[model samples]
Target chain A: MIKVSILGTGNVATHLFKAFSKSDEIEIIQVIGRNKKALLAFAPENKTTSDFSDLKESDVYIIALSDNYIKTVSEQLTIENKLIVHTSGSTPMNELSHHQRHGVFYPLQTFSKSNELDFKKVPICLEAKSKEDLALLKNLANLVSENVYEIHTEQRKSLHLAAVFVNNFTNHLYHLGSEICEENNVPFQILSPLIQETARKIETLSPYEAQTGPARRNDSNTITNQLEQIKKPELKAVYELLSKSIQATYGKEL
Target chain B: MIKVSILGTGNVATHLFKAFSKSDEIEIIQVIGRNKKALLAFAPENKTTSDFSDLKESDVYIIALSDNYIKTVSEQLTIENKLIVHTSGSTPMNELSHHQRHGVFYPLQTFSKSNELDFKKVPICLEAKSKEDLALLKNLANLVSENVYEIHTEQRKSLHLAAVFVNNFTNHLYHLGSEICEENNVPFQILSPLIQETARKIETLSPYEAQTGPARRNDSNTITNQLEQIKKPELKAVYELLSKSIQATYGKEL
Candidate 1:
């Protein structure tokens, strides 16, 4: 059995704790967090602590803290010759290099407090300093997820940036759509199916092939009409920039 | 049973044809298309015609042509005292006002030839010059879809613009993400689950509430790091503009 200790009480940490607890082959040695109250939801009082100096000996120690605190928290862990890992996509794996053995165990998915994520499908990106450490990371990752990759720090950085565009920017567009719907006294629910289908299309077709709009067609009249409809200067600017981008992508003039 | 004749043979037209063909309550009298090659997919040669003047009498005529051709095709139809409707979101219902009766049967969803869409869940937005014409349009809409709304021209205009943002613009973001993944030697499949989850989140939470990322949290360090990682000038511009827009939405400085 692989014994593990999870550090941090954030969404990623809590989710990791729950997934680990469910596996018979994996044992949670402890869950360490500076905020005891946040750790209460993950483990009992006996297996939870706020102290980092008194660390438990485990097969792996996962630091699932925020990006800014990853290096600071890793420096505080004085456990020697242990497989230490942090669950971050943007932060380089070298952040934990202060320890004898360090690696990355990043899950490529957004985690919300209320979301009941199915860990089995989520891709777990692992990176380690040695082949033995890499094998251990992969083995632990396979316990919770079927999708695992030995991603290097450079690739992981690109993945994180791509994620921001697809998830974060896409959500902002939805927000703009909602605002437009509200101003015109239309229910935002009307656009829900369209949003879902747009996501579903990329499963079968490439985004380049699936793309369609007035901007792609270079329909200047519809583009002008749409611009006139948008009242906010920010939204109008976004609309114009994205439209120009799309037109340029298709070798068309705006 | 409501007898209907369909006009055009594009993605929207073909989808409407297939949907209307499935319902026992609706009988498709004839399929009209200027391009005879495209009409073969919908109906046999006897029932499909290129000449709009050869159109047969029906309870209602549905012009599911492109937005630019809605008026041109509607003016060509010689049938009088018939409830004529055009299936377009951006085009106003009055485009068919030259006829005895006119209405809009706008299905608010993206239609593609390859994708099999569930017409039942797709919202059909209806508008007409008279209450009786509106009822006729609603009856035909109800035959294929469960979700129907009585939306006026002004509201439909706003809905179409909102859709451009959520569906078209959102898909463009997916393209950008795919480009990033390719450059990093990462399979775009790694980002697919994240895309699906982002769309699924808005089902329960508002887009504003569901938003999360470096920009939403105002993590300047991570944002700066991401911008530096991006290579191309155009992509860098998109990244900077969208990041700034997202930050501005959450009351943060870029």
Candidate 2:
């Protein structure tokens, strides 16, 4: 069995731990974190520790902390010759160059503790410093997912940015819609079907081709009326900025 | 049959024309548009004309023009006391109140001429000046869709604003993502699965409850790293604005 230790007990850390712990080919030797309580809660039935020195015996040590903390944590690891990997798409896999083997195992999906994840289907982006380590990363990823791609660190960085748009920015817009419904005393549920349809449509069409509205139509009058309808200060700013963007892309703004 | 005449051959008009024509209860009597080329392409089995006065014979004259042109088109119509409706979400139903029987038939779906619509599922918001006309509008919507609601003009205006967020702004972010990918030599299609998953997750969760990312965790280092990774000027602006919005909603920045 491949022995592994994971550092950090945050969202990414938690999800990865749960996913990997279920496998028979992998043995989680240690789960490390600064917060004793969080670490205890996140640690599986095998082992738990708050110190990196306690993880030297494992074949691989996975850093699942925030990007800012990864550099510091990597510097403190006691295992120098073992493979070290981080689960960040934007953070370069070379950040752990201090180690003999370095890699990245990034699952390109938004995760939450309560939300059930289908790792078998989520795309796992893999990268490593050497062929042997790359093979190991791919093997580990294959155990958890069906879609594994060899993405370079630079490509992964941009894919992460794209993720921010589709997942983070899109969800913020949903929040805005719910807020508007609240102000109008309409059930936010009323907009749920339309919201689902918008996302579902992209499965078959490009976002640019799916685009519709005042900016697409170049209907300056409808744009003016809709702008007038928006009462929130922050929402109005969002509307104006997005409008300028749409117009810039299509050159259809009035 | 409720004889209907459409006053524009734009995205909304073309969609509604095809949808209503499919229903045996509604007859598309004529189609009026300034561009004969566009009108001819609509391929309606009924008469097609460019004159607004030619709309007089239909039982219901539907003005699916832009907001600035709705009043002008209504004024140009020679028929008095004929049931007149405008297919606009932002424009007030009263804009057509000059007629004795005025109403609205706002289909709450993002439409494109090439994208065939399943009107049976689209939420059709109806509003009219009188109970009789309101009943007529509801019946008309029911003919095309299973989901029909008698929403007030004010509430429909609010719903339209909400759509600007989910449909328009969400799509703008998608555009931004594609631009970022194209500039970085990364395949934009790689992000498609993530986008689909983000949207699918919301079917069971509220956007506020489903929110995730560096911004939600208050991990500013990652946010700063993402800002540095972003090369496009407009995308950086979008990232900053959306990050700020997330922070504002959560009462902290990452």
What TM-scores do the predictions have? Answer: 0.98, 0.86
Model 1 alpha-carbon drift over 4 Å, by segment: A252-254, B252-254
For lDDT, the strongest prediction is: 1
How far out, in Å, is residue A253 in model 1? 11
A1-254, model 2: which lDDT tens digit per residue?
Answer: 78888898887888888888889998888888888888777645357877667664887788988787888889888676788999998898888888878998888888777778777777888899999999988888887788888998988988898888888989989998999989988777767667777877776788888887787767787788888878778888888888878888888433
What C-alpha lDDT values do all the predictions have? 0.91, 0.83
* Clash tally for model 2: 3
> Which stretches in model 2 have alpha-carbon errors above 4 Å?
A1-9, A17-61, A72-81, A252-254, B1-3, B21-34, B39-52, B55-59, B231-233, B252-254
Position A169, candidate 2: lDDT: 88
Give every collision pair in model 1: none
Worst 10 residues of 2 chain B by lDDT: B51-60
